[model samples]
Target chain A: MLKKGGFVLSAGLVVLLMVALIYQIKNKYYLDILFMTFFWASLAAAWNISGGYAGQFSLGHAAYVGIGAYSTALLYINFHVSPWIGMVVGGLFSALLALFIGVITVKVRGPFYTLITIAVAELLYISAIQLKELTHGSEGVSLPFKPGWVNMTFRERETYVVLALLFVALIYFITKTMERRRIGYYLIAIRENEDAARALGVPVKEMKLLATVLSAFLTAVGGAIYAMYIMFIEPDSVLSFAFSIQPALMSIIGGLGTSLGPLIGSFVLSPLDMFLRESFSHINGLNLLIYGFLLVLFVLFWPEGLWPNAVRVYRKWRSGGVETKS
Target chain B: MLLQLTVSGILLGGIYALIAVGLTLIFGVMRIVNFTHGDLVMLGMYLTYLLYKGFGLDPYISLFIVPLALFLIGVLIQKLVVQRVVGRPHEVQIFATVGLSMMLSNAVLAYFKGDYRSVQTTYSTDTIQIGPVFLGVPQIVAFGISAVITLVLFLFLKFTYTGKAIRATTQNRISATLMGIDVRRVYTMTFAIGSALAGIAAVLLMPLYPTYPSIGEAYLLIAFVVVVLGGLGSIPGALVGALIIGVVETVSAYYLGSGWKQAAYFVIFILVLIMRPQGLFGQRGAEQL
Candidate 1:
């Protein structure tokens, strides 16, 4: 119980720090970066529920993002529906899509499921490009700003940052709740051994489907918010392989299956990504190379992720300098 | 037209079979999918291009040099990197290869600047007159070379002592170790041969398709689809699976719009995966997560 309290206290401190930094950073550019980081953190947390916690290892999460972005964008463009309503619709649609994909792929485990997810995302990407009439193809779509609460837009970056922080907090709470529940135990069980879980009378398929649907729904909400933030959406930008890779990278690099993993990962890696992109834009593909190299390095040297290492250190410090197992 | 589509599809299928066979070989022998298989092919193409452009060598002749080079690279990478994580978690293996792939591709991009480079062979423009269709000589040569290589590989696997050891390792690693076969040597050899085959395929197909750093992505996707459809650890199944995909892609591209060609193949791929998880010619008990 004290451990749990400590965890909550640390989380609260981090949130307070984020709020302080938002006000401290006067530059709009830095605020933009913070907002983007929080946004990605929220999505990465969503990805962690299915990928990190449930061990699904989905490689096509961009499909959900694209579906949410496009669905919301289309409704807003054609019917003039407020983004608030469209966001829910988009999330529901993505959830349904996830349900469909999960039903088909839940029987197969491991890399097979990962590959199918990639294929599904690729198919959606291609369709988005080919179906020019609806999607505008490669040209993409831009959202009209209503400059009000209904549109979820404000003139200042601070507002966006606050909203993103709220979203991240909500997602973190949900994940924490799930982690303490029976579903979390079942997910971890299935992750470790599917056959064993099934033999033990776990509803493996249903649990997996539920996890996937939740993942997709939350990811879609993130996408909806992203669309509102960017005020633009495109197939290539929204559904690219890189977008899919980011969540996985964040979850893995932070600490898979842990509540704080995705958040920590995004907090660290998003800044690196932004820095690399800005610095290496002239170097063609160097950014991706660096990203991949970092992933490899993390896998080799720190597979449990940065958060685990931090936790270990924290435990050691709290125990009055007791030597810990490596 | 249908006949023409069928013939073209068959020819393209032969190339797909050759590409996928290497992937299957690596997976079959070591249970490791060399995700960089396509990048090795890209390296092969670049090597061939340089040999032809600088040394005035024919692509056929450069094939010898490229495969040998890629074999060395494969051997070195396997010994240095892959060996370190032989029995580690799947994520480690995946990241290692994915890292190698990214590094190689980006290095190529930095060097080659994303230019579409192709070998300009004298016979590149030549074509054979088929019934209501034209078959390019380069493609015909690629198909013939693929067939010959496949046959040689099959023969080698069937007859040689080392080949039998590889097959043994593929079937049961512990049993092969028990039988006194060195599994490490088999892994190194498997990676080398697989990479060498990719090199050969690259040289064979260079005249027909443009080469670039990003070109590997196209082949990687196709190889992955074929490997899965072929069943991960089955060489013959890879060939048959490749043929199916190749034929499907060809016919679809010919009949439908080019944009929808990939979609059609992907649809078929998904359908096959759902309907028949075990690919054609794959053993019943070989399916793994």
Candidate 2:
């Protein structure tokens, strides 16, 4: 599926679909869902950097997102800076924070490390709430929307979708590039067996830190974009546990470590999320209940996620093959 | 002033200890950190709350029924979901329980519509006379019940055959299986007992605190921290960790703001993770095991 020709073909198909979606979307509801799907796919692709490909699970991506959202919002609110620039500044800030945390926590692996990531993010969340002078406290910061390219805010909805699509495509391109290189091989080796990778003289800590920094930077960019689109940034909204989990969920669902796993995951889950919001608004938790059930079923039945399986089936049909097990 | 803080902290610690003991036990035996533990506590709250609301059963009287009901639910969850994920990778195990956490909490949200519900008894505001620190009757009762349950659990693990088998399994699953222990049965019982304790915590807390679908998160986070600080599988360690957290929370709330109390403990948690990931009493490689 990731062969150069195949990737090009698929990318063409997706671009065509995006083109159709932009003008054809009459329902604002479906447009919003599509926009979110692209946005979360981008965010999840960022998470896939450390989590999916590198096999370093961080439950603290929310920390970076929160930092990004808050940094851009605060800067724009106080200095009248354009968010187009604030996003870069926010990305840099997130990189520094990630470096400090990665330095301390890169050694720990597995669930213990997952716990540490959670703690760090929760600490950031609390700090955001308590440090009102800088963060504007729990009330958060709302951007005064002035629709223009300079502000990164747009008057048209489709423009935002186009921007989000570009972000996802950029992240996907980087992921594919990394996957075909020595760096990707090193990360895969480290994930498969850290001791073996170390014996082979891989700079395990450095690679892990690099992956974490890149992941945090991209996620922060996504955060900055989201804040501008919504014109509001709050700790609970951006720094939520659910925020951290969503990307991980999407990546895992579509197929962790695969180039297009997060995009597929987002495509599947985002519509459901939108449907539940629109139709089951009164049902409160039914959407999440189904989501949780699906997650359980996926982990149990197809831990490799739906992407690989879909590829295998498509290949089988294309080859006109007999019924045979992989 | 110090004495008052200490007394209150200890009382709060007792409540936290109840939540942590069950969590530690599950981790000890199954090697799976039950992320849905807080949800179980929340479910127990709704169960008792429903009884009080629908049937007019008093919160104090429904405690008995609530634990038993929760025990059955625990057994069902163990047999159905958790058993499948045992001996799996951390990713699978973590996500499974986290999935369960999302489901259970959201299920409650769907049913209850995210409203906070409280059950107040006839003596809801009644307080017992303590020399320096003012103690409410419900808190005193919760603390007393927690103490009793902890003692009983300690004795059970020490003297009972089933408990001994559980300890053996926790120490070494293969050896326990070799020694003719029904390791799976022991796992189910441990899960049930742990869940039942969460139910007790729910019932005990109902009189003092309001029940919301998300209320369990704060308690759950405290449980995770306490479990780690106390040593992953040590009951006595959980007790000690809870006391430390409780004191830290009360002290920080006094010095800092109440809003930052949980944050204060989270800092301590990170420090502990960096300085002593094995916790105060955990063995080396305990986390890996």
lDDT of 2 by residue, B58-177 (tens): 888888899899899999999988999999877788888878888888888998888889987888899877776787788788889999999998889889999899999999999999
What interface RMSD does every candidate have? 1.7, 1.3
Predicted candidate 1 versus true structure: per-residue lDDT over A1-326, tens digit per residue: 45777877887888888788787878987888788899889989999999987888887899999988898899999998888899899999999989989988855766667778888998999999999999999999998877888877788778889889988998998899898889999999988888899999998889889999999999998888888889989998899887787888888889988989999999998888788778777777776787677777888788898899898999899889996875
Q: What docking class should model 1 receive?
A: medium
Give candidate 1 regions above 4 Å deviation. Answer: A1-17, A320-326
lDDT per residue for candidate 2 within A1-326, as digits (tens), equals: 37888886788688878777687777777678878988899999999999987788888899999888988998898998988889989999999988988877754667777877888898899999889899988897888978888888888888888888888988998898899899999998888888899999998998998998999999999999889878888889999987788898898899988888999999999888988888888898787888888888888778889898888887788779754465
List the DockQ of the predictions in order. Answer: 0.60, 0.70
DockQ of 1: 0.60
**C-alpha positional error of residue B7 in candidate 1 after TM-score superposition, expressed in Å:** 1.3
Looking at candidate 1, what is the lDDT of residue A85?
91
TM-score of each: 0.95, 0.96
> Candidate 2's error at B201, in angstroms?
1.2
Off by over 4 Å in 2: A1-21, A24-26, A318-326
Q: Which ten residues in a row have the lowest lDDT in candidate 1 chain B?
A: B280-289
